[model samples]
Target chain A: MSGPIDFYFDFASPYGYFAAGAIDALGARYQRTVNWHAIVLDANFQSLERIRIPSSVMRSDYIRRDVERVASFMKLPYKAPSSLGLHTELAARLFYWFNDRDPQQSRAFAQAVFKAYFVEDRNIAQLEVLQQLCCPLQMTPDDVASVAGDSATRARLKAEIDMAEARGVFGSPFFIVEGERFWGNDRLPLLERWLDAGTY
Target chain B: MSGPIDFYFDFASPYGYFAAGAIDALGARYQRTVNWHAIVLDANFQSLERIRIPSSVMRSDYIRRDVERVASFMKLPYKAPSSLGLHTELAARLFYWFNDRDPQQSRAFAQAVFKAYFVEDRNIAQLEVLQQLCCPLQMTPDDVASVAGDSATRARLKAEIDMAEARGVFGSPFFIVEGERFWGNDRLPLLERWLDAGTY
Candidate 1:
């Protein structure tokens, strides 16, 4: 009788990239559906009144090292991005566009994007880069572009971000299970426990 | 052959309060000594150029929920402090003063301070409040004041904070295991794993 687990994230967040790899399998282990939502983080950062992390020297250094360490611990392949904090708005919009029709395809799209950024060190903010990523998912670059730029598709992505903020999701790789909010990739263990034991 | 785990924290941090409950036991499980250090966070926050939590409306609400949930998860008793961000400079300074002399008593003193702030909702910033805390440790209030007021003690505490900053500790409840840094209470599990089987 439980609802699907909501896994909200920004594609640009490396932690989000890390969470993406594990969340689905975790959901399957608990017999729950993992609903992936790629939402923009700019609005959340604005509300928190903080600058993007890669813009800061100290935080970025910590994050760079932490990501590598976390990747090693999680046993996921990770390479530092050539550029950090690349704008993820287009990637998010395309995810909603694909998700509206096919949830499975959208997840594949997300994985490809994550690999492109974290593993390949590609600049995901560029349209050509994103378009090249679509080929592996069997998505046409032209079709991907058209849908990502559609007004309705943009609106859908915006609404998701708005809902995330209203739900008090102020960080990436956020999860909500039956109204309980757990933020950050670090909280995944707690999320798994909640899904398994229905919270303490 | 294992080194003492350096557990750095700030008294005013809620996460620090939560971590204090379990760090020593975790160290014991691995047969490692937990060396507690109450370092100032103001310098780190200034370097990061960010306002402290509990000062922000949205963040404080999330933290209140997070601490309670984390406490429930850890099976520890917790109550939200009536006030937030009470200055802990005096508490930290006194901790170093006592720690230099007797490591055991300083740890007990720290536990008392954590309980006073988190469980009792006592404002720990007050000198008299700290004096009252020392009584339980069998130290007279005057004696507590004398050591905390010593310029040499204050200088020692400042030096610790300076060293922590240089080592790239930018958050409370920070841990360094075998020359590797892990920040936040959320990283405790990773720290435990590193201690048990060595790092990946």
Candidate 2:
């Protein structure tokens, strides 16, 4: 049996959403398990001395165009969110809580959240918006609130970020299979090749 | 006639070396001329407020691994240069001088330089190393010296860097095919797809 693919992403990243949609099928094809971990990467950016300014003109424009083009090529549905820079703490905490109990349901929850944010252009920053996401997953408002506000869940997510940084994860949609790290969705092909061939 | 593909690179960038090897063929496939431009991207990095620490551990390690893996996957020979951060201005100037005379020879010169610096791990920063490279293209030592020390050649290379920055080029291995910008060697597939489909 192949090793599990450790997939790390920040909840607010569109690239992460895109990778989530594809990584599982990729893992299954290679006889590997895909493990998704939601992490707050603001600290990673801070370490790199990067400022998260929304309108950094040229880069922002290129990223928007790139994401759209990638979605088109992959045939994944995407729409630019109504407002940018929505905080993702609530959504991440809820994910961790679900993942702690039922890993399969948590993956479903993650897909729904990505769909809501990227495809539906819904604001995921709000609890009510996340609460609506729970309905489709057959989860209750109580379950959503229970995890969303859980101190332990929040701490676990924080610890995950620290652990990711320690493991040298600096970008979204980052993957680690059998100790080799691959960054960016663009590297998916290379990652597939790595799995197809035992080694280079 | 199709618009030329503007290929931008920093001479010292490993990824640039890899792209330099592949881009002309890519251009030919689409019936487009590949115009190679070498730029000093320090100013762009400055604009992004980037710090140029030699030992940024993780990123540097990842880049080294990425370049080697990519080279192996592409069946291209590669070796990390003996030293990092070699200045590329002299090479860029000489390239422009040759390019002004014969574009085909200039492409050959660029490949030789990439091989010398990457495969042989030669110090491209040195005049003798560059002079030796000019020999393969049947260029005289005087020709190499003339371009290496020419004020006009220096100005041209500087102008190219400025032009690249104006065109929003912030990274090496950036490509503009028919005015659509593709950044990174990883995007080469998408670029190929765009060429094949005549726009996405």
Question: For model 2, what is the error of residue A96's alpha carbon versus the real structure, in angstroms, after optimal superposition?
Answer: 1.2
Off by over 4 Å in 2: A43-59, B43-59
For candidate 1, lDDT tens digit of each residue in B63-157?
66877878888877789888877788999998987798899999989989998998899999898999999997888999988987889888888
TM-score of chain B of each: 0.91, 0.90
Per-candidate RMSD vs. true structure?
Answer: 2.6, 2.9
Score each candidate by Cα lDDT: 0.82, 0.80
- Across A12-120, the per-residue lDDT of candidate 1 in tens digits comes to 8888999999999998988898999898876434554331333353235666787887898899999987788789999998888779889999999999899999999
DockQ of each: 0.40, 0.35
Model 2 agreement with the true structure over A161-193: per-residue lDDT tens digits: 878777778777899888888888988888998
TM per prediction: 0.92, 0.92
Clashes of 2: 0
Q: What is the lDDT of candidate 1?
A: 0.82
Angstrom error at residue B38, model 1: 0.9
